[model samples]
Target: MNYYKDNVSTNVVTSNCNYVVTVKDWPAFLNEYNNFSNTTLAAYNAAYLQLGGGGNVAPGVSFLLKFGAFLNLYKADPSSDEYMPLKLNQNNA
Candidate 1:
């Protein structure tokens, strides 16, 4: 089954934040999951827990798989995962 994208959030700055519903459907799912407003690591853990069990075989396998895909994508793209620190050139600029 195709895992549809859903609510996604990212933090532009560090602070306690709330998730804004950036997108509602497929297009929105991709857009928002790729780009977020204020979702936290702890929040993600909680969500994962709420999903029941771990791995793609868990209760909400589809949803978890979609999240896993987004996580991979987030790791791959710099502009996407703001939580990731930019690698600074060792040479003094």
Candidate 2:
């Protein structure tokens, strides 16, 4: 089966071994995911350059900065899953 929303298309597949699964606008999802990833990477690269492109900065700080960039990108897209809080198992691992 196929579905479309906001001009994006999705295909659904099912079988005896599989449940009712939905892709939900795959092409648009990929495009948006790639855009967010690329933008975050670019921001991280710029920060690395500013920090002399070496081990001159703390790794935690660098990670936080890159994460902040990702948050900014997510904020720009209200429909993105990036805004969802991560769920972990009881083991927390």
Model 1 lDDT tens row, 2-92: 4334445443322332222222345545575554445776876666665544443422242434443333221123333333322223331
Worst 10 residues of 1 by lDDT: 84-93
Best by TM-score: 1
- TM-scores for every predicted model: 0.26, 0.23
lDDT of 2 by residue, 18-72 (tens): 1112233456556656866778787756756565435565433443333333321
State residue 65's C-alpha deviation in candidate 1, in Å.
8.1
In model 1, which runs have C-alpha deviations exceeding 4 angstroms? Answer: 1-26, 34-36, 53-93
Model 2 whole-model lDDT (C-alpha atoms) = 0.39
Give the TM-score (vs. native) of candidate 2.
0.23
For candidate 1, the lDDT comes to 0.38
